[model samples]
Target chain A: MEHLLPLAAALPLVAAALLPAVAWRRPDAAWGWAVAVGAGLLGIVGLLLRRLLQDGPFSYAVGGWAPPWGIELRFDALSAFSLGIALVGVAVLVFSGRYAQAAVPPQRRAWYYSLLLVNLGGLVGFACAADLFNLFVCMELVSVSSYALVAAGGGRIAALAAFKYLVAGAVSSLLVLFAVGILHALTGSLNMADVALRLADVEARGPVLLALGALTAGFMVKAALFPLHLWLPDAHASAPSPVSAVLSALVVKLGVLGLARVLPLFAGLDWLVLAPLHEGLAWLGAIAIVAGALAALLQEDLKLMLAYSTVSNIGYIVLGLGLATPLAMTGGLVHVFYHALIKATLFLAAGAIIHQAGFRTLRDLRGVGRAMPWTGVALSLGVLAIVGLPPTAGFLGKWYLLLGALEAGRPGFAVALLAGALLIFVYYLRILNAFYFRAPLREQILAVREAPLSMLLPVMALALLCLLGGLFGSGPVALAALAAARLAGGG
Target chain B: MRRLLTALALAIVGAVMLAGLAGLPRPGDPAAPVHTHVAAHIVAHGVEDTGSRNLVTAVLLAYRAYDTFGEVVVIFAALAAVMVVLAPAAAPPPGKTAPPPSPAPAVAPSPVVGFVIRLLAPFIAAFAALVLWHGEALPGGGFQAGVILGALLVLLSVVMGRGLEQPLVPAAAARWLQAAGPLAFAAAMLIGLAGAGAVLGLPAEPAWGRHAVLLLLELGIGLGGAAIILGLYLQMRGH
Candidate 1:
């Protein structure tokens, strides 16, 4: 079982080596190799999560050296976040099979598969890393892969978008490196727990606070939070559908996880105060929710709208994080998973539409529901779940977040939360109305049919997970509660 | 107006960050926590524990080897990305699976440059191998050696006045070679499991097994780094 710890990173890497070789002789086998790696990863991540839940949180010291001297990877209830991420990786690889054949050029399939597996390994390692420097390396791994993944769809716009995303990500990464340098100078420890322990009486309040600020700003850009999110919609929209799904579903969340990993260092410490930071995050989140939803309402491109909606959804999670109560933390963590499920469904369904019918804008996709009913149904369920209808997986995160907001005595945030939900409903109605009520604007809509089983299975599975995530919300809620308890208790 | 707004926003951010920076401790305090704790231990004992006279190599290969493994993978990902983006825009139409056409037109090598490369290649190879061998004891290590070798290879290709995908090192072989660093580290991780039960950990006794593992891993990094750097150059130039 301990061996499984390092294998999470090693397996995909070994696959990364083998993938291009497989791609050389049998371009067809590349996808199979990626799926095999993802399946192996799925089992490993699932076992890690189960073991963590059963035995409580555990930490592995890499290379048999204990920490303060070596790196560590820790798994707690919070790692449930990655269990879901790993599942999404598996589903997306499976989904990309038939979808990539049409959307990506034949020559590029192996490269795409290689990038996807490497990206997955990066995410898994990022979630598990407890060493600050290790976290930086892992963050870079995901960011670099995503920058290229964004460009994989192959168009002038995609190249431009990838470059933009690269610039933003590079700044974020540099800031993280700077912060790590400051922390290292202050504590001489790269192991997070070790640093936290050494910094108990940090004398120079200014540098510590400055480092925290740098880190927060860096992660904010990566997370696409509010003003820092300028690169997101374009990067997410222009990217191929499966790539978009991964970007929206998994990539940004790693930024949030990076923040979660670091914030614990200064939780109750005096040199770096956290109260004001949380307060700032709440207002930032409130603005993001309203601003993102309003912007989403005006988008013409279907994928662009979904991308902006991701911005709005990210706000909910951040707001919950800002609320800072145990319940709010639970909501934020749970939303992290539920949103991944819903957004992946929405984007994959949208990808199917684009692949089959060649439409991108809402106006162009009018009456697509009648032509591709299965994709439409999955899209409708995803829209329902995202709009926070009861008994959907999406509802649980919002419910906890709203309750946390109200309980924390921030009724204004609760109002903002509600208003954001209502605003989201209006735009989702626009999508549904176009799907069901609007007349078919083009002859191509009549020729469209259900997506292939490979793509559709993952779409439907995620939609069902959303429905069941809500129906069986108790499991996630309990897990999230436990995670929140672990976080609050540790810091 | 937009420019003014942008300026105003930038000013506000600068102000906030300045406020935060105002609070940091003075740099390099001799009595700081860093000097008191982790740094003291590593400087005092790291060499003894990891058997590498170079503290950086010791830390990189033994104590924090897992991070180095991840670092190598990140490099591989960057190479893969460059390959994907530069994939010949005019690849044979889907379903055709034709052999890749010859690389973009090769630049003719000047006689002086070819003569220089011919003279330098052997020395560079010897020096790179020397660095890889002595990495555990000296400042030179896998990355430096890899760069030296990789530069020589690329230089050779340019001087030969040919595309990179020759029979000597085909595209498939290049990809595998580029990944050699991570593959080596992965092998080390498995070998490491035999000793420490923890991934990438060396045995407490700092002797033969450890040195053997270190040499294997360093050679892997040296070779991997050279392959990837050359591969990246070829991808950009060839495409």
Candidate 2:
């Protein structure tokens, strides 16, 4: 199972490379192949996760070369996020079967699934990477695949959005690569653990600060934290729904996770005061929460609203990290997992409605709930979860965040968090009202049927997970706390 | 005012970056960590450990093969991206055609130019092969050879006026060729596991084993890179 660490990331990529060839004669076969690969990935992740639970954590040095000389892949508590990635990956792939048949052209379908697999492979690799250069490489794989996935559905607006995303992604990737290079120069090792050890002896505070600053900024942009989030809404909203789910649920978290990974690198440096950075992050996160929800409230398009909600949710995670309390960081990490499930549920359910009814806006999709009850119930569960309603996955993270804010004696931030939640609730209320209460503004919505089992199954499973994530929240919360302890250097 | 603000932001960022870079060790300083740490190790043991005369190839394919594998996938993804964005809508019925978005060169290639390219083609191919074959012992390697071959193909296509409508390689074979980089890496990974007991580990016993693995990677990367470049060219040409 420990040996499976590298295979977990490699299998998806190898399968992806073979997909177009295998499906060349019959493009329809691409869907089955992608789902099977995705399921295989899930199975591998399950084995790794079980191993992680039993043994604590494990590392694999590729090519039998030891760390600092060879690339190291670590499956630690922090990397437990691979479970979420694989889960969402399989769901999204299963969901894409029906969605792509409608949304993507037959000729482009194989490439579409191929890119998604590459994106998933990259995300898993990024989570497990312990080497600085390896992290950057996996990040590039994810970024390139994501930019293309945005334009995969193919339209002028999507092309334009993809270009915007490309510019932002390219700049961020360069920043990360630049920092990696600097770290290598400073420490003479590309391994993160080795660099952290060596960084303490380095005399150049300027370069150290610069590297830290560059990494934070780059990852923040990738995570789409506010102010740096200009490219996210257009890109996420315009992408094909499955791509949107992957980007919103898993890809953006890369930045937050990247921050978590690199923060500990500079933790041992005495001259570097992370307090100022934390303070700034907390303030910005507070602003993003209010601003993102307000922005979501104004959007008529369902996908657009979901995209903005992602920005707001990212704020909650960042705020939790910024608070720098064990509880807070734990909350943030837990949200990272839960948000992936909840957002994926929302996007896929919303995707089903839009695909079936041909209506994307709230007003256009009015009374869609009655027409598609299961998907509507799933979307509602997702909506309730996202709003931080009680006993839902969303609530636990926010509750922890609120307690963390108070625990840190920052009532002002606590107020901001509560206020943001209220704003989210009000906006989500509008969705519920529109979805369940209003008369059908578009008659075709009445004729729309329940989403097919392929799409419905993934959405329902995710929605159920969103609920289970809350009810059985202790497991993930414990896992997150373990990760948080390590990030805080307590372990 | 907006332009001035933009310039101000750019200048500030540039100044900060420059300041940070200023703190780095002086270039080519032998005592710097970059030289003293991993580089020193590679310099000392690279040849014996990896059995490549050229240290760079040793580093790329042996010590840090995973990163190289990642890079190969990145290139593959680039081609996938291009095709996803630019591929024509579901295959047109046989014998039906949409006019090319951009017209072919208005004038034909000069006879002399074509003749010169035709004369140079075989020599270029031979040179590419040499570069690839000798890469383990020299500075030239897979990526460089790939660029050379890809450029030659692009040049021939230009002189021949072969639009994507009639690709130099058939579409079916082209897909596999474009995927050759990752496919080769996958094969190497399994071979490494069987012979070397690790994924991507090169076997040591048969003096020729490591060389065979290296050559396989070189061919895959070289061919795959060239195929992808041509595919990109043909796609962007908008037939």
DockQ, per-model, please?
A: 0.63, 0.75
lDDT of predicted model 2:
0.92
| Fraction of native Cα contacts reproduced by each candidate | 0.73, 0.71
Compose the digit string of candidate 2's lDDT tens values, residues B199-228.
888899698999999998888889998888
Best by lDDT: 2
Q: How does candidate 1 score on lDDT?
A: 0.85
Candidate 1 stretches with Cα past 4 Å from truth are: B1-30, B93-107, B165-168, B203-206
lDDT of 1 by residue, A1-491 (tens): 96687688778867876688777877899989899889998899888877876887788888878887888888866666777778889889999999888767776778888999888888888888889999998888899999999988689999999999999999999999989988887777888888887677677676687788899999999999999999999999999899999999999998787777788887757545577989999888889999999999999899999999999999998888888888888888899889999999999999998888888888888899988888899999999999999999889888999999988999999999999999999999999998889998887888888888998899999889878888888877888888677666645
Displacement of residue A17 (Cα, Å) in model 2 is 1.4
Badly placed stretches (over 4 Å) of model 2 are: B90-103
Model 1 chain A weakest 10-residue run by lDDT: A266-275
Best by TM-score: 2
Best by DockQ: 2
> lDDT by residue for model 1 over B91-164, one digit each (tens)?
66668764464564445667898998899889989999999899999998898899999888888877775454
